[model samples]
Target chain A: MTEKEIQVREKQEVQQAGEPTKPERYFVPPVDIYETDEDVTVLADMPGVAKDGVEVRLEDDTLTIKGTKGGNGGEGERVLLREFESGHYLRRFTIAEIIDQAKIEATMVDGVLTLKLPKVEPAKPRKIVVQGG
Target chain B: MAIIRFTDRPLFRNPWADFERMRREFDALFQGLTGEYPRQVGGTVYPALNISEDADHLYVRAEIPGVKAADLDISVEGDTLTISGERATGPAEQRFSYHRREIECGRFSRAITLPTRVNPDQVGAGFVNGVLTIILPKAETAKPRKIEIKTQ
Candidate 1:
């Protein structure tokens, strides 16, 4: 009726984009990478992703993270204004050789992926003791 | 003979405008929200979100990671919907200095005005993993209806 009414709502409903046309969309999860005394921890914000749907791989010096989140939408549900489009999360970081890849640990809680990259023995911080005079 | 200095920094290249530098800057945009939740939009906070509406319901979904469900508090009054929660910053153990901290963790609250009227009594929400979904069904009178034309 009025411009205000039309402005509030979208003119038309947006149909869900199905595969066979456009490829899957990937979003890089927000991440915090910091190194501690003994480990390099990376916290990635990946909401809507389940623990089992996530995959972490370390090959060579590259560490890759992939997660597929489900349950953003349902069948027969017409989307009017789409914002949080559901899809896959992909991010890869080039790691240094000093990291102990074998000891890398990953934990997912409340959609955040916590990756702990333990440092090698030589890379860990070692305090030197001074002899008393 | 004059000695030439080997500098990896490109000559005339402004560090501020570099692609990687710009991205890193963009990532840090939300780092300003490392405190209590403020009551303003674009204040730059964690967990980007999307609010959309359909004929029968208005939907709001927010990206919240590493936050427990119990820590989240969602409420709706009138046309305003608010999602407030806290995300633990890091591991309990004290770690080393931060090489780079991009992800924001702390108190965050987002209160937005809905595009249409909804029944507060019929509001439904779901928190799975880290995504919080709020489904507010439109009031009966809010839904649009089709009118028929009669033949002579």
Candidate 2:
């Protein structure tokens, strides 16, 4: 998939990392979070961000999702109207359960980011069976 | 006399831009006393766009997240161009209930009249990252013609 494609290109841009002189506009991407039988799923709309432009990080109990979308609008194109602002996507959420961080998986399709965070099995309720009395 | 006015506009204008303007005025004039709840008029909820034109083509770019080319329908009739599409809500088989919901999802439609005639067949569109771009080339006859000077 294109997911790996982004990682390969990411290697080239690593040396140039850090804050730039001009600060960019950062906006929160809308998200829908749900908890299933064994996992929690997060779906966020982060249009314009490519696979390489997205970042998901977990530290302590906080989970952060960041995405950057590069736009090369045809030069000299005058804007006749404006509706939405184009910028970076940044969002953070605190986890309530002990999540299996190693088991987390994320995918970017079109402009949507689908994240699966599996809960630690030990955290789920388990029933013990009694032998013959 | 034609006078140009400028101000902050809503997110999206309805198909009828003229009426959307009128509705905004009415919404302001009537204030909040009406029986129904007051709401901003003709504002787009997600992915705003911009339209621009040069001599050859009209350029349009919309910031739509997760919009697939197949999920969109674009057409041009007369001077108006329309774009409509749906944003999929992701896998439908999640058995768990939604803990929190904030992103808006549904079919969206918007149409705008161009400033000049364009050749529909020559139009080109591209979707990158999540932005949708459309280049509508001007019609052959509509393009300005330059007359060459004759030598003395």
Candidate 3:
């Protein structure tokens, strides 16, 4: 085939890690975290998760992200090829004290969750001008 | 006596990289010990796919997170269905540093040879919540037909 074939990867199920209180299978959603001067942003890929199904929580220094996938195929659909399995998502991160928890903002778009943690104002550097005597 | 001042500055190296590397090592070790890892081939593809079918239509679903519908292109030729698209990178800023970078962003194209023949003109596709679904209606020749029993 001249065209490059997209590889198939099965989602890794979350096992022996952060077991949810509810009895449901979960997968570790892949994430990307980048830091700018003002804030540190986190982008997580939670496919099939709608805006109403995702939840973000910050307790102490741990940031937790959880998302529930809606559903797979339509009614009475037969499976021909099952490379990917649908499941809920769960992941946690240890945030630093420099982040201003009060100003953290999160948004979901197209099954991707973006969390922006702005830096505390006091932590930013300030310039001091000197007056010549 | 001199005092050393500490400031809340970003680390030079990404801390998450260590965690990821260690996790991969652990996974490899466990896979070697048990020889029963679900995904024998590690890492990931551009877009993972799942194919299902109904009586009339064959559905092909792909998970392409962070991809916009406008950036995707789907074409069908004969028995081959191709999904090609570019996943744009995060905000364009040279000053930004990354703690964890796992998302793959670039031009990606995947072509699949459908299990059965489909009507090229009737193919329909939709994108929602980072998932792209293409519904390919089976050709008339491919659908099952029933014949009434003739009695003497």
Candidate 4:
């Protein structure tokens, strides 16, 4: 079979799985990506998500975020005017080679997710010394 | 008059009648003191607020843990500032039968009056770590100026 035929077969299998043919729904939080001298910082807004509920994983070259938000329950008649429904959130990003995967650190505070991705040693700046004869 | 004659008199009277009347009266008094009645008795609670000040600016930080940037509305009129937002609740039909809920959710609005005049054009707002930081810079005239000292 040709390469195109193999690609078509894979697409058919994915469609049959009853899953979204396109990428998963992006729970793109309002993320601020900033870089300092030592590392790059990623600040993500993941409200109602506890520290224990958040899951950050890196596989191959992809980084993924997954979490669940618990519902609110009370023993009274509720007249809800507006609702912000929460569900399992998933987001993945393809990482670049400049990232030092081993040195990555993640912390969750007040439902915000902060990831610090340090650049590789070779990617960091270094000063050269001059010698006068 | 319609009941001019005593037809039948009960041998015993309901003693709890007086107690029930007292309970109702107490409830009414409590409601009156609170302004709004029962329906408004229990609602969403507001989070704690922290404010800091420096020579250049005043920083107001609110602990709004579950609100998103898109859901938030911030407005400043003169010296009055308001921040309002709604938090995301979980999915429909995904109900929790019994669980301890500590985090606050629902619509919240907070207003603050500034101590000094602020430069509205230079005001900055940022949300990080589930805390909203609003920076209000002092007006040029309100800011402290360094006076030149002449050697006599």
Q: What would the per-residue lDDT of candidate 3 be over residues B6-64, giving only the tens digit for each residue?
A: 55555475978788768767865675466222332333555666777888999998888
TM-score of each: 0.65, 0.70, 0.76, 0.39
Clashes of 4: 0
Candidate 3 vs 4: which has more DockQ? 3
What is candidate 1's lDDT per residue for A9-107, written digit by digit as tens? Answer: 111211232322444456777688888778888888777788898999988788889887775664445444343445678888898747887788898
TM-score leader: 3
Clashing pairs in 2: A47-B65, A48-B130, A84-B48, B11-B44, B12-B44
Q: Pick the candidate with the highest DockQ.
A: 3
Q: Roughly what TM-score does model 2 have, to 2 decimal places?
A: 0.70
Model 1 regions more than 4 Å off: A1-22, A74-86, A123-133, B1-47, B92-94, B146-152
Question: Which of 2 and 4 is ahead in DockQ?
Answer: 2
Candidates sorted on lDDT, descending: 3, 2, 1, 4
DockQ of 1: 0.25
After TM-score superposition, the amount by which residue B43's alpha carbon in candidate 1 deviates from its true location, in angstroms, is: 10
Fnat by candidate, in order: 0.55, 0.62, 0.69, 0.08
- Model 2 lDDT per residue over B54-142, tens place: 77888887766666889988899877988888766556745778888866666677778888889998889998767799999998887
Error of 1 at B83 (Å): 1.8
Q: What ranking of all candidate models by TM-score puts the best one first?
A: 3, 2, 1, 4
Error (Å) of candidate 1 at residue B89 is 2.1
Candidate 2 chain B weakest ten by summed lDDT: B34-43
- Residues B69-138, candidate 1: write the lDDT tens digits: 8888988898898887766656664656665675665677667777777899989998888878888999
> In model 1 chain A, where is the ten-residue run with the lowest total lDDT?
A2-11
Per-residue lDDT of candidate 3, residues A1-133 (tens digit):
4444444446777765642455456888888998887998999999889999989888888988999888765557766665566678999899884778789899999879999989876656779999899
Q: Model 2: share of native contacts present?
A: 0.62
Predicted complexes: DockQ each: 0.25, 0.27, 0.36, 0.04
TM value for model 1: 0.65
lDDT of 4: 0.57
